[model samples]
Target chain A: MSAVLTPAVRRPLLRRLRPLGNGPLFTVAVLVLGVLVLVAALAPLIAPYDPEALDLRSSLVGSSADHLLGTDQSGRDVLSRLLYGARTGLLGPLLVVGLSTAGGLLLGTVAGWRGGWADAVLSRLMDLVFSVPGLLVAIMFVAVAGPGLTAPVIAMAVAYTPYVGRLVHGLARQEKARPYLESYRVQGWSGWTICVRHLLPNIAPTVLAQSAINFGYALMDLAALSFLGFGVQPPAADWGAMINDGESALQQGATMPALAPSVCIVLAVVAFGIVGEGIADRLARRER
Target chain B: MSGPTGLVVEGLRKGFGGRTVVDGVSFTLPPGGSLGIVGESGCGKTTTARMLVGLERADGGTVHLDGVDRSMRPRGRAGRLERARGIQLVFQDPYVSLDPRIPVGACIEEVRRLHFPLDRADRRHRVAELLDQVGLGEREAAELPRRLSGGQRQRVAIARALAAEPKVLILDEAVAALDVSIQAQILDLLAGIRRASGVAFLFVSHDLAVVRHLTEEVAVLRGGRVVETGPTVRVLTEPQHPYTRLLLDSVPRRGWDPGRIAAGRRAPA
Candidate 1:
């Protein structure tokens, strides 16, 4: 690890990262994510004042130094709420989306690599879930399993496993036809080894591209659930809950709650879309 | 690594639905002897090779080595994967026959890992030996197939096939995809390998002239049947079968030479 930071690897990593620094999309995503994550992770460090420690006299107040982004209906500092709220809005989805994407990558890799009954069984079960509405499935799951960050991640993983799995399955089938893969098979390398050593490296670029798309899909799904009150609960504050809270305030003209969270949602989704498109094009060119 | 071992195929029958692609295909190679199968593309030459190596199953037939009739049955489950430990196939495309991601040495070295499972240093030494046998060196082995020319990749492919140290080697159009100059060079390599290792080779080709350059005996296949089989010159100059004569006639002759129909190689109304 120490040697890795030496001149050779670092130079290439910096060169690739250079493109990222200049790209408008990358800059915006990094900025938004950086602020949100920092404020969330170091709430004690940078938050000017306590979040739950509020002055009711400041209730429903508009932005001031003491109450930037203003105070909510309960007089909780909206800025403070926004900061702490990120810990849920961003953190919850980050957890849920990350877990589900990992799950999807695994199933997709397995289904793609292991054909026959393994593919058939996983494909059909995923089809069963894809047949029904994913959001409806998420709702039913929250109803039965009880709503928490974990439940939605589980629900979303089950709902979207087929999407990633199908992509993986298709990619794996194509990879099996590639000359190099055939070379390994003829070498009489065992099946498991071939899948891991040969197939995994070939399939990685496609799976990762699909995963980025999955991350965006998971974010939108989770926010929608939170909007309907099935996601991370409020009073703890979240982007989706803030959207719900700001509806009446919109009539009253305090728009930051609705505006800010929505902006975060759009930014997260578009970031994933841009990164996925870039990777997908690179992979398509390679395939050609 | 190939040629000390022998291969035998008997009554090898494989089919789709009820249509047999390869039917009753049978042959044997004495240790280090070579057998050439000349066939048009669809006459089941590739399928027979695939079955001999167990890539595809034979519905009914037996593959034997050392007079031990191998799972003397179809290409199906149970026919000599144990046998495959010593049998290798050199496919048509040198480009398609190797994993592009690894260095050429790693590809040959893969067989060493399979049969010997040695540590990295020992494996590298073995691979370097195999590469030298195929007219390559450690420096050549370190490069990837993408970096090499078509002929060189094929040479690497041959090195990889020999890595298994098999007694029998199958060359399925191995030189067919190459240009004539390159093909000639590969033919010379194959001949040298055969002479040195006594590894029996089953060379499959459509070009009789190219086969003429490498093989001792030739079997001409037409529609899954051997139309002519004998010593190479006997089959070529003194062709007994009409199809063999027509096939020889199909070979392009020099300027002002008569076409097969005008030369009695083919009938003219």
Candidate 2:
């Protein structure tokens, strides 16, 4: 398929990425995601103070030039911690989306393209997996594995696989029924090639939008897990962990530290939702 | 021209929920032959056409291409693909048949690349040639299926099928979706290509006019069975089966009045 690649042929794809209407929403979503990713990537360089360094004298201090945003109960720089927190905040969801999308895509395509006994077995397995609520399952796994980053990440990845799998399976089944698959089969294209090259490309936008939506859910779920003390143990800067750490500050009449991370979590989720919606709208328009 | 591969089918049968859709259908087309399977909806023509091209597997029949039983073709990836390339099927709706995401050139190149080991430049050149053969130019090849008209998309689909170098081309209501004038143009194009390549054709259509124009031999199907089989002119002008006569009678006659038809029924009453 790549044998005919030309620079001229790629222009249409680039144009497709730029959403025609709802320009502001798409632009804002992209800008928000870009800023967060840049901040996470540049955390070591841009942070003013060590995220873990303790300043006992400055405990519970409010926002200032020396320690922006304020100091937590542990006297750690809130700004520095928040900036570093962006790393784990983003990485966890990235892991969940990546693993689940891959697993889901594979299983879904198999179930979809080769229906009958295969579809029945895989779909029943998905049903079994989907029956378990993701957050509850993650908590249970985290309990068994002991509280840590690896535990929650694994738990959430497993929990979310069925959701992505079902989406891909349905799309694959629908696409499988189309005449193009028959055409490809008659042309001697392998079933694998048809699923990967042709079927995937058609369903990719929807899958991508699904991934973005999954990202938001994963982000919120991970944050809640950390808040419940099952993810990202203390001494590590995490938005969710920071929010938990700053909870006592709220009782002490110092809400900035906790509120800051809470706001960041909401912003990240909202950004992903906007981006997913934008993609879905663009796909619908393109189909029309 | 290279001599065509003859296709022979016998006792082809298919069923869904114990209801047979194609029951004991059989036919033979010699090298460079064109056969039309004409029927109305649910007549099993499409099922029979699909089975002959390996799109739909037959439960109880043998399909032989060029004296080789299709089932006896090799079983491995390369071998199966090689056998599949010997026959191709073009579907009814060009809009749904071609992938909307890929450009028309890439669609054609996909089939070519699978069967041929040509370099990139040669593949691109061949794609251009195929497009031109179907009455499309270089600019149209760069566009996606959505960018083309119904007729143009069908042309691209035909071009893609031709890229496989098939000995037999099965068109299952392939042109039934196009406008009458566009259908005429596509039929002419098919005739020209057939003359040049000598590929045998199994043309399935509900349109008797199109069947008469594109096929030499006609097989009229009704209720999952072939009711009449003969030359197109013979079957159309002197239909032996009552079902065939009923189908031909359904076609509207020019200058015929509905009031006169009512008057005829009134005369019988």
Candidate 3:
């Protein structure tokens, strides 16, 4: 007449799915980014009109049916440009995330695993890179490479990979010393399996968190480059370019141009933050 | 006396910092024969035990199992998998030994997968039988380490050690934490297991009473150095070295009858 308490059951993936939209802010932010990614992914289909179509005769006009949100200094539709801009903003961040995670995971795993001279050398170099702000690095990169979306993303990925790498390096180092890992070592497990299987699974959450933080930074850097006229060149509807154009028209009492792009940038960064925080919280709780 | 290969220690030496922890200790046992190592706290009993199973590195000396001096520490995937099948350990704190996140059934199942490569149903059946052999209910098979009592955790640890079913089982302070009565029960279980399966045991403890009751041969260590060793009963009743004798005396003789014993010895004073 005895019973046992099994270890905590692993909840099914569906059950673990959070009500991500339960919080009003998280929900609204997700919706904005969702619409943004969708707009960017299906830009060929969803954009109502040619983003760069000129209507110079009616340039700088106020909001109306012919040119809702008004025309820019050029004849391009402001709304159309905004929709088109999503491709640049979203694509830049996605590319940065991919490149940084890839580079950081390899470097961090090596540094954490080998440690000693290798860890010391890699970490110090990363520290030096991290000392410089990512935006500054992107600016420097654009100055050297010339203005382009890829240039800004690459710059950000390089700058941010160090942060993600160090985070992973620290976690990987700690995981290697755990008893289970040592036991696995004595069990004749290859170093590769120990690294790939146990080390990766445990360090994944940290890497994921780093990626989220980096993704936010990458988006902002892209936006910054766009603002400076180094990214998502003319004829494209980028948030930063929208903000840039809006700033000039500010003297003429046009505020929506600036406000729309500014809001989009904030929403995108905040969404990445929320998703990162969510993943971090789930991982931290399980560790307990 | 004979079954499979026996464990051999030839001049095994290990040190940490400036102090030598296990100094040139050596011994051999018939496969499945139980040998208890008795030592004080700072002695190298645990360290020597760890070296045999490759848990800790021995600075000098060779560990020869079946007359083969092993080189190349088993590390990484294939090597670790091979080591898991070859040797297994039972740690002191049953509370902290088995991973909390891993269930008992799954923990045992892991060994089978790594070593035996059994079918799913057989693995499940073997896991249940292992739990039963260790005196746990079938329902408790799926439980985690936290849900089990200290004795039960130790039992599960024992079950875990047996899962690998290695040629040598290194028990490092394995059952010292249990209550006196519970200690007896676990010791009995270990004895039964040794009798049935020829798993050479390097049982480490500071407890004289338990070692006397369970082990066939005894090795007494003093500061990582084996001072005296012989048959378990002889070593207990008539220890040669002063250090070994002090270790025996420290057990605090129980049930002394002052009046009855004094009456028999009277005339002296």
Candidate 4:
């Protein structure tokens, strides 16, 4: 596909990234994501105070030189908690997206290529999964297995599989219908070889775009679970849990406790959404 | 040349949803023979070609290459590979026939690797050779299908089919998509290939001129049955079947009348 591109069209780096969305907003979203990841990675070094330390005398103090963004109701520094919260905030969604995408690719490719009883069964299973709301599944799993990140993450991963699976199933089925696949089969290439070598690569970009968008949704869902006390228990400094813990602080006139993490969650989710949509737009244009 | 090495298909039958698409279609092409099956759309010419290559399983009858039965759908990898060595097909559409993401040279090399137990170096050499046979250069070999023109892609498709080293090669309207000049070039190339290699040609086409040019024997199909069968020259110049005459008259030439052809086409056989 690259062979058809003219040198003039291929020259600019910005032109290549243009498919990710309009220039300035896409760049800003990427930058926000980059900063969040960096902050999460270097939380220990960047944070000025221990996120879990309780300073009762100084609790609920407004922002100052001593403790920026003020202390939460529990006296945990809001700024430090926000930085540390990035780790769990990003990690939960990462696991959900990774697991679901892998499962989706496997099940979808098999269903699409085989296209008989296997397709019917797998498609029905996916439809069943699709019928259930992801958050409801996560909450139910949390109720059964006790509250923690593990149960909800696994549940959400299973719940999210249908979105990716259905997309991949449709795309793979369309791709399998192309004459090239039949040509390969006619050449005596095995079905496995044709799928791994030709079919997967062609559908990879679209799947990648979907995964990017799924990452954002997964993040928000996980955060909502944590807020409901079904994920990331207290003192672990999760964005969703922090919002919950800061509810009392909001009434005490220290909005930074709840407001700061809320802002961060919204920023990360919106950035991921923009990046995913941009990539999808670019891929659509390239196909056209 | 009449030895049992070439394709011998007898009474091939296929029906979709109780409607017979190909019914008791039969033909034989001896080694080095060129046979054309010509018909209008829905005449089962394409279905017959598909059955020959084992892409479509026949409902009944047999397809034999080199005295081995290959009529049934292959059971396993070994069965499929054995059948592939017997016959190969070059599809009608060039644009969608080759894998878009794969380079042309690799596409040819893949078939070579699958059919033969050649080392990587030998496979590469053979790939170059096959490309050269199809009038493509090393530069085109490294490029993807999108970079090449329709004629060039068709050439690559031909090269890929030849790499399988099959005894029978089925061209299912293989040049129908090309313009006149390119079609002439492809026809010349195919003629040269036939001379160079004794691979039997099963040319499936609707174009009377192409059938006349490329085939020695011709089978005229109508309504899922052969309406006429004879030497290409005899069939084109002095068609015996009324349906064959209608087909020939339908071809545009000097003073061709669309109205008369339409009426003739509308009339029942």
* Residue lDDT tens for model 3, A194-247: 688667876777788768867777888889888989887876778888888888
- Looking at model 1 chain A, which ten-residue stretch has the lowest summed lDDT? A18-27
| Each candidate: RMSD | 4.9, 5.1, 6.6, 3.2
- For all candidates, the clash counts are 11, 0, 19, 1
Highest TM-score scorer: 4
lDDT (CA) for every model shown?
0.75, 0.87, 0.77, 0.90
- DockQ, every prediction: 0.39, 0.66, 0.32, 0.73
Judging by lDDT against the true structure, name the best candidate: 4
Q: Which stretches of candidate 1 lie over 4 Å from their true place?
A: A1-14, A17-55, A66-68, A79-114, B1-5, B16-19, B68-81, B118-121, B255-269
> What's the TM-score of chain B for every model shown?
0.87, 0.91, 0.89, 0.96
Q: Candidate 4 DockQ score?
A: 0.73
CAPRI quality level assigned to candidate 1 from its DockQ score? acceptable
Clashing pairs in 4: A20-A278
Model 1 residue-pair collision total: 11
**Which is the winner by lDDT between candidate 3 and candidate 4?**
4
Worst 10 residues of 4 chain A by lDDT: A13-22
The full ranking of all candidates by DockQ, starting with the best, is 4, 2, 1, 3
Q: What is the lDDT of residue A80 in candidate 4?
A: 94
Q: What would the per-residue lDDT of candidate 4 be over residues A40-151, giving only the tens digit for each residue?
A: 9999999999899998888888899978898988778999999999999999999999999999998999999989999999999999999999889998999899998999
Worst 10 residues of 1 chain B by lDDT: B72-81
lDDT of 1 at A230: 85
